[model samples]
Target chain A: MTQPTARSGDRFLAAQPRGTGVQSANLADLLERVLDKGIVIAGDIRVNLLDIELLTIKIRLLIASVDRAREMGIDWWEHDPSLSSGKRGLALENRRLRERIGELEAGRTGRRTQSPDADYEDDETPPARPRRTRSTP
Target chain B: MTTPDLTWLYAVARDVEDGALDGLTGVADEPLRTLTVTGLALVVGSVPRSGFDERALQRRLADLQWLEAAVRAHHRVIAELARTGRTLPLRFATLYRDDRGAAAFLRGAGPRLRAALERVADRAEWGVKAYLAGAAPAPADIAAPADRPGTAYLLRRRAQRDALAQRFDEAMAAAREIHAALAALADRAAEHPLQSAEASGRAEPMLLNGAYLVDRERVADFGAAATELGRRFSGVRLELTGPWPPYSFADIGPEVPETVDPAGTGTAETAEADVEADVEAEAGFGADAGPDAATGAAPRIKPPEPRSPEQPAAAEGG
Candidate 1:
C-alpha cells in the first residue's frame, strides 16, 4: 500500500470540483455509486472457443441516482428485503392473516351459538334408544 | 495468437473540453484519452486483453493487492474527469475490445447518458453515515438475588436484552432524524441499506448510510447541516463525507435501453461457473463491490468551526 499522502484525509475535499469547499471521494463514496446508481451498460465481450463461450465478459454497468433510477424504472431494491426495509409487504401480510383468523373464529363461534338444538338433539338421540343385540337372549 | 489490446472505459462526459483530460492517466498508468461518440466523450485507456480477460480478471479481483491498484487507478480517472464536467463514471474495469465498440456503445445510449449527466449537472453527492459507537451501557449489573438464583438469572438476562433493544431503537431514531435534517439541506436524498459490521470494519453498528444530491452552491450549507446534526447527535458517531461524483444519483434513467446486452453478468464470477451468485463485493470497509475493501482509519472529523454562516464561505479553498 502507498504511504499516506500528507493530506490524505481531505484529499477528496482538496479535489473538490471548485474552491467552494466541496470534498473529494473515498473508496466508500465511490462504491456507493458503483454498486447502486449509475448507468449499467451491458457490453458484449465474449471470448469463444469451438462455439462455446470460454470467456464471457459482460460489463453490467449501472451508475445513476435514486430519481434517475426511478425514472429509468429500475428499482429492484424496493422489493428486496436485504436491500430495503420491506415493512409494507410484511405489514400487509400480517393484517391479512389477522383478518382471516378473525373471520374464521367468528364463523366457528357463530355456528356453535346458532345450533344449540343440534347439540341437544345429538345428546338426547344417543341415549333415547336401547341397543338390541343381533342374538336376542 | 497475440492478445488483443482492450480499451478500458473509465467515464463518459458530455461537452468536456478535449484539453481538460491532458496528462490524466488511467488503469495500468496509460495516458487517458477521449473517444468522441455522437455527443458523448468517453474517458478511456488502453490495456492488454490478457490483463482484463473475464477469467483472469475474476482471479485478479480476489487478489487484494492487484485489485486495490486497479480500483484506485480507475477511480482516480473518474474523479479527475468529474471535475472537468458532468461525467458518467463507468463500472470499474469496463473493458471493450477497442474504441469502435466503446463508441458504438456510447452512441447507442446517447440520449439516456445525456439525461443522466443533466440530472447531475450543478449537483454533487454527499454521504452521511451514523454509527453506534458502542453498546448502550447496561441498565444495571446487579447480581442475581441469592434466594432465587435460577429465576433471577433469567430475569437479569431478559433485562439486558431489553435494554440493548431499546438502545438500538433509540439509535435508529436518532439516525432517522439526522438523515431527515441532512436531506432537507440537499436537493435529493437516498438511504442506503445498512452495511454489516464485518463489511464496515467498524465494531460500532452502522445506523444509517445515506447519500444526498446537493446543488453545488449549497455544498457549504449541506456541510453545516451535517455539522449541526453531528453536534445534535453526539452519542452517535456521525460521518459526513463527500461532494462526490454524484455516485448515488447518476443512473441512466428508468427506461432500459435496447442497446444494452440483455445478458449482463454480474461481477461475482465463481471459481467454477456455478459459484454462488453473490454480487456483494467483499465484506470490508472502503470501496464498493468488496474485494479491495481498505482497512484505513475512518476519515477524521475536525472540531466544529464557529457557527457563523460566513465561516463556510471563508473556509473555501483553505
Candidate 2:
C-alpha cells in the first residue's frame, strides 16, 4: 500500500481532521504520553519519581475539583461492575457468607453481641446516601 | 557570576537537513538547535538556568499553568521535527547543562538510540480508546402481587442487579474483542492503563486505552479496522487518535541513572562537576566509535507486511 510521497507530517495532518495540534489535543492524553511514556534520558536536571507523582496527584485534584464544581457525579468506575475486579466480587461474596455465618451462630447461641437487624440497617443506610447524592446530580 | 543557560532536549533524530529546523521554537519559545554527535542529532533549545535549574524546575512542575504551557510547547517542537523525519521524543523535562553535556550523553547512548530510531522509522503511533455507551437503562421493576408484596419486591431487586452484571460482562467482552482486532493490524501494540471518567472528561466509562505502532503505509488499514470494530461492538464507542510520534514504543534499553544528590543541598557547582566527569569518562573511552557508528544514515529494518486474514471478515461484517 504505497501512499503518496508527501511527507508523513502532512499526511498526519490530513488524516486527522480533528487536528493533532496542541490546541486540539487534550491535556490528559498529552500528559499520559509525554510524562508516562517516552525516551527517558536523564539530563542534568533531575526530576525524581516523587515529583512526577506529586504532579499527577495535583492534576487529579484539579480535574476532581472541576467535576465537583460542575456537580457531575463522574465516579462511575467505582460503581461499574465490569470495571470492578474479580477480587471485589469475591469480597462481596465473602461478606455475604460472613453475614450468613453470623446469623447461624446467633441462632445456635440464642444470644447476639450485635443484632443482625442492626448490621443490616447499617449496610442499607450508608450506601443509600451515596446513591441518592449521585442521582441528584 | 551568571549561570550558563541550560539545553532543553526535545528529541533525537538522524540526518536532519540544513534549515529544517529554521523558525522552529521550543519550550519558553527558544529557537531550536541540533547537536549532532556520532551520527545522532539531539534537537534542543536554550532555556535560562534561572528558570530550569533543579530547584526552579521543582517549583515550576508543581504549577499546573506553567506545566501545561511547557508541555504543549515541548510537544509542538517534537511534532514539527517529526514532520521533517523520524524523531525520538524525550520525556518532558530533559535538560542538560549545555550542548557538550547533551553530546556526551548522546555518545554514551548512541547504539541504543540508533536501535530505537530504527524500530520506529516509517512507523507512526496511533491511540485507540473505547468507552461504554450512555448509561444502561435500569431494568423495569415488576409489580408485586397483592398478597406477597415483600417477597415480590426482593425478587424484582435481585433481577435488576443480575441484569446490570450481565450488561457489564458483555461490555468487557466487547472491549477485549476490539483490542484483539486492532492489535492484529499493527506492527506493535501497547495497552495503556485506562483513564477514569474524571480524567477523560467523558460521562461514559473507558473500556480500552491502547497505542499501536503502525507502518506508515498501513495507518489507513489500521484506522479502518478500528472504525469497523466500533460498528461491530454496539453500545461501546471507540475513539481513534493520533499519528503520534512513537512515545509508546521508544523503550529500547535500560535508562542511564540521573545524578542523585544524597545531601539535601542541590548545589549547581557539584552537579556540573558530576556531569562533566560523566561526559569525560564515557566520551574519553571512545564509546561513540563502536560498530554502530554508521548510524548517520537511517537503518533499514524490513517492515512487516500488513496482516490481512481476520481484517477482511471484520470489514465485510461491518
Candidate 3:
C-alpha cells in the first residue's frame, strides 16, 4: 500500500487480520500483505527475544526456493538424512566448474570477462556434432 | 516476582466503537486489548514471558509449525472481533510491556493506522487460488528440451509447450479479470499481483493468489460472481475463502526480503535495497480450511513432525 510498510522480523509484535478456516484466491497477496506489510512499531521487551528471532529468519529465508534447495544437499526440511543421487551429480558439476576455472586461467592469462557453461560440454550422447563419414564398412 | 513481563498487542480500526470488542481473547486465554488513537481501536494480545528473548523468539519463529500456529491463532481471534466492527490487524508478533505500551504504539501510529483502517473500512478480504494441476507441470514444461538437437524436433516441442503455456497464462489472466469483476461489485483489490510459484514442488503451487476487500453484506453477491465465473471456466481450479478481516487492504508492515540461493543452503529476508521477491508481492498464508487441531478446521501449518523425519515438510514455503 502507499502507507509506510511494516518491515518483517520484529520479535515481539501483535495480530494481523486473519480469516476463517478457508484460504481464498488472493491468498498469496493477502499472505504477503498480512505477513509482510503493516504498521511499523519497533518494540523493547524486557526479556530478550533471541530464541524465536532466528527461527523466523531461518525459515523465513526458506520461504522461497525450497524446490531448488532439494536439488542441493541440504535436505533438512524433508528430514532426509541420507544423501540423494542428485548430490553426486551436483558434485560432478562442481568439479567441472573448478577444472573450467583452471583452464580459463591458463588460456586467458588470468583475465576473463565471461565464463562458459562448462558442465554440459561433455555429452557422450550430444546430438549436435557432425555425423561421422566412413568410406566403406 | 513480576507477571511474566508479558505485554499485550492488538489490532484496532477507525470508526470501531471504543467498547465495541473489549472482552475478546485469543487461544490460551490471552486477553485481547484495544488501543485507540483518533477514534480507531488497535486490537492486540500479549507475548508470553518465555518468548521475550531474541534467541528464543528466533528459534521458535523459525519452526514452521510454530509460526503457522501462532499466526493462525492470532487471525482467529481478530476475525471474531471483526464481526462487530471495522478492523485492521497488526503484524503478527506485535507485543508491548502493558496497556500503556499498546496505547503508545497506537497513538504514535495514529495517522498511519487510521488511514489503514479507513482504507479497509466496510470492506472484507477474500482469496482466490489457482493451480496448474497436471502432476505438477514438469520443468520441461517451462523450458525447451535441451536434448532436442534438430531444429524441427526442438521447434515442435517448443511450440507444443508454448501453446500449453499460453493457454495456462491466458486462463490465469482470465481468473484475474474474474477477480477484478467481482471486486468491482464490492470493495477494492488489496495489493499487487501474486504468483505462487515460490511454493513449488507441491501437488499445487497456487498458480494465482489474490485478496480482495469487499463489503460484508455483499459477500453473497461476491461469492455468486465467483461461482458463475467458476462455472464459466471449467478446467481451472477456483476457490474463494473468507469474509475475513481486510487483510489484503490493511497494513501489517514492510517485509524483509528473504532470498534463498537454492544452493543447498539458502535464506529469505527483506532488505530496502530494491531487492524484490515474488512472495513479498502476494498476500495471505496457510489454508483457512483445514482440520482445527483444537476443535474444527485448524489452519494448515508445516507439519511439525513429518511422517519421515527426513522430509519435515521442508518442502513448504511462504
The lDDT of each candidate is 0.53, 0.60, 0.46
Clash count per candidate: 29, 0, 101
- Model 1 lDDT per residue over A13-104, tens place: 33443433233333334444554345555654432111000000000001012333355444533432322434343333333323333343
Error at B266, model 1, angstroms:
30
lDDT winner between 1 and 3, please give it: 1
Is 2 or 3 the stronger prediction by DockQ? 2
Q: Mind giving the per-residue lDDT tens digits that candidate 3 earns over A28-68?
A: 33344445434435665422222222222223223223444
- Among incorrect, acceptable, medium and high, the docking class of model 2 is incorrect
Q: Report the candidate with higher DockQ, 1 versus 3.
A: 3
CAPRI tier of model 3: incorrect
| Sliding window of 10 residues with minimal summed lDDT for model 2 chain B | B277-286
For candidate 2 chain A, the 10 contiguous residues with the lowest summed lDDT are: A128-137
Which digits, one per residue and each the tens of the lDDT, describe model 2 over residues A15-112? 65223453324445778777766777677898643223233323433322322313433343232233234435424433443344344335544555
lDDT of 3 by residue, B11-100 (tens): 676555556556656633577665454465666666676764455665565455455446556666667656666777665566665556
Fnat by candidate, in order = 0.22, 0.33, 0.22
Residue B137 in candidate 2 has what lDDT?
Answer: 49
Better of 1 and 2 by DockQ: 2
Chain B global fold similarity (TM-score) for predicted model 3 against the true chain B:
0.61
What is the C-alpha lDDT profile of model 2 across B15-119, one tens digit per residue? Answer: 687888888778778888888776789898899999989888876765654575687688877877776678898888999888777877776666667777877
lDDT of 1 by residue, B57-92 (tens): 655554433444566577667777777678878876
RMSD of 1: 24.3
